[model samples]
Target: MAESATALAIMGMALVTYLTRVGGLFLAGRLPTGRRWRAALTAMPGVILVSLVAPLVLGAGVAEAMGAMVVLALARRVALPVVVVAGIVVVAVGRAWLTG
Candidate 1:
């Protein structure tokens, strides 16, 4: 009974949120909003990426994580592969340091 009630509540919340998003799109047609709003919406992903990456790059409040982030930035020429290698190195070193 409790589980069913919780599931119902969750579904209700999701339905409401979906409706809100659809409503926003519907209302956008009526609004006199400009290109700036569209541009800002388009930049949302970049904004989110920076927000997510910035803290991780600066520090994980851990030295290994910090070092890996710096090296990742330095290896911009081979960004994807360098990031993968840096991540592996940071994890290996961090694990070793923590365990030993």
Candidate 2:
């Protein structure tokens, strides 16, 4: 694609992202602030994370499975940053060991 077309595509994506964020904020402001809603909102991140990771875990090879196991084991004990780094390292090392 031409430079102008690429720039336009990027701008379009940015606009869409910004609009979605604004729409979410607008919707959130209108939502009920009840206890059930609060609880659901609190759990939303974990639910979303599982939804995203479930597919990868189900389809993964040994290396990815092992990495996911490590992450799960450390999730409650360690901070998120630690868990993330450990997961990445585990997957990288496992892949190397398996394929080497």
Tens-place lDDT digits, model 1, residues 1-100: 8999999999999999999989977886786568988888779789989898778656654656656665767677667767777777776787678777
Candidate 2 lDDT tens digits, 3-33: 9999999999999999998997778878899
Instruction: Please report the TM-score between candidate 1 and the true structure.
Output: 0.51
TM-score of 2: 0.66
lDDT score of residue 74 within candidate 2:
97
User: Candidates' TM-scores?
Assistant: 0.51, 0.66
lDDT of each: 0.76, 0.92
For residue 57, give model 1's deviation from the true position in Å: 3.7
Q: Which sections of candidate 2 miss by over 4 Å? A: 31-43, 78-82
Q: Can you give the lDDT of residue 12 in candidate 2?
A: 100
